[model samples]
Target: MRVAFVSMTTTRHRDTEGNRRLERLAHQLADRGHDVTVFCAAWWDDYRDKRTIEGVTYHGVTVSPAPTSFAARLPVLLARYRPDVIHVRPRPPRAVFAASSGGTLARAPLVLEWYGDEELADSRTVRLLLREATAVVTPSEMVRTQVRERDVADERSHEIPDGIDFSLIEDTEPGEEIEVAFAHPLDEAANLDSLLLALAELRGRDWSVTVVGDGPLRPDYERQAADLRIDDRITFAGECSQQERIAIYRGAHTFVQTAYREYFARELLRALAAGCVGIVEYQAESSAHELIENHRRSFRVTDPQELADAIVESGDLERRTIDEDFARFDHRQILEAYLDLYRDVQESHGVL
Candidate 1:
């Protein structure tokens, strides 16, 4: 199958989860012998043209900060590519409009992929895209519920979570000092303050935390840990390579995430795959709680105290049976599901 992916950005332009997911999807599809072409905006010097990476072709549409110029050129590029299906990550309204129009012009089925509930709030653009889409896919049921509540492609919408490359993670024995792992772009919304406060609650506990990832708020978090007098027990490792991150996850006894709004908990999933106990905060907007709600070695907490308590209790929890918990999110399973969705769309459109 020849598939064309339309997105505002790619991992080449930004190192965001959404961008990385798209890149990985395209690469996986290409590896499976499906011809995949990515149509995305050029945000950097090296991205301002056509390039092939990992067997997939990427066409960078040059634009200024705004997507206006790229949107104007999308239809022309889509017509030239003339793929069997057009998979669009609907972000900016202009990009959606262009992809929808281009798919129509090219006589190809349009699939809309959403990562969160943000697009559901854009009634006009979302309605327009839904009307033009052959199918809609989101990473979680929480976002799907919002899509349904808003009457956006109720019948055609499907929930397909982001997948992890489980092969890259290696299991390791939990380290001494009750090593706890927490990773996030240390932003204001990350709720690291709550995590630090919670850690402080465990005053005499023989646990230490390794904070991974880095952002502008790292210094503030460090200062808060100092104020709590637990700075000695916290290690600000900052950013780490993928291999380093997997090792950290493998060695930790528990992994905690306190973000207020996580669309899909990618890091948490990695932690589980690495054999770490999972403890997630219950945020109304986050889907992290859904992943570990009923699991034996996983927990959901509402407050910092609860989180603290969960961390202390995590050491006693049995090792998680990873197969039962993570089977649905296997990369191979996700790829097959996507292939099936593509075929179904193609058959429905009489293009199979």
Candidate 2:
């Protein structure tokens, strides 16, 4: 299968979770003997042309950095790639226009893989774009419900969970010290204030808290830690490469996810793979709930007291090992699901 990935930007964009996910998908598909090509915006630096990464080809279409929109450029790109199937990742509001434009140009199947509702456009445009999509892929059932309620095509919508690279799980040295880690860009939705308060309550305990990732809210979070008098026990390790982040995951005994809102709690998956006991907030309609509901060894708490309680109860180190339960979201398994979906779509269209 010749698959063309159409996204606003590639992995060059920092703090971009969706771009990294697309890169993983492209690499997985390519490794399985499929011809995968990425159609994306050229980087702002010296690279004004095309390139390749880990066997997947990238067609870098030049667009004005100031005034250009991805929607305006996608039509030209689809004509250039002419792939058997078009996979569109999350984008700005222009994504709806781009999907429609690509659909008209390719005459091939289009799949909208949405991470969250953050990038969605108006209702009319969303319905129009989804109506043209051969399949709509979302990371969780929570997102599927959102699309359905928004009147997107339920018949074409599918749940495809974001994958984790299992390679990062091997040869990891689980640290001897007891430390709880929370890795995410500090944002309002992350609700770090609550986590900080909980951590403050456990200050004198034998546990240390490490906060990873950087964002606009870092200073505020830092101030909160100072006010709580737990600044020394809390380590703010800024943004890191994938390798570094995985190593941090490996070293931690407990992983905390305090997100007030989430599409899918991917970092929690990485924590599970690295053998950390996870503490997450339980919202029935949130992505975190969709993944860890009824799962043993995973803690879901609603309030600050519950989060603190879960963290305290998870001090038993013997039960935190990564077992068969955490093996379900590996990259290979996720890739296989995608391959199955592609084959199913092809067979249904009588193109197989």
User: lDDT of all the models against the reference?
Assistant: 0.80, 0.75
Q: Candidate 2 at 216: error in angstroms? A: 2.9
Each prediction's TM-score against the native?
A: 0.90, 0.86
Lowest-sum lDDT 10-residue window in model 1: 170-179
Off by over 4 Å in 1: 43-49, 62-69, 117-122, 171-177, 319-324
Tens digits of per-residue lDDT, candidate 1, 1-352, equal 8999988666655566666777789999999999999888655466358778789887877653358888899998998888899998777667878887888778788888877734346576677766668888888888788667656756688888889777666343333334689988898768898789898999888888899989999898898899999999899999987777777877777889898878888888888877789899888988888778767788888899998988888878754324345656779999999988988888887876
Can you write out model 2's per-residue Cα lDDT over 18-116, one digit (the tens) per residue?
677778899889988899988776675664567777888877655432215666777777866767777887565465457557756765667777767
Cα deviation of 342 in candidate 2 (Å)?
1.1
lDDT of 1 at 305: 96
Q: What is the C-alpha RMSD of each candidate to the true structure, in Å?
A: 2.7, 3.1
Total colliding residue pairs, candidate 1: 0
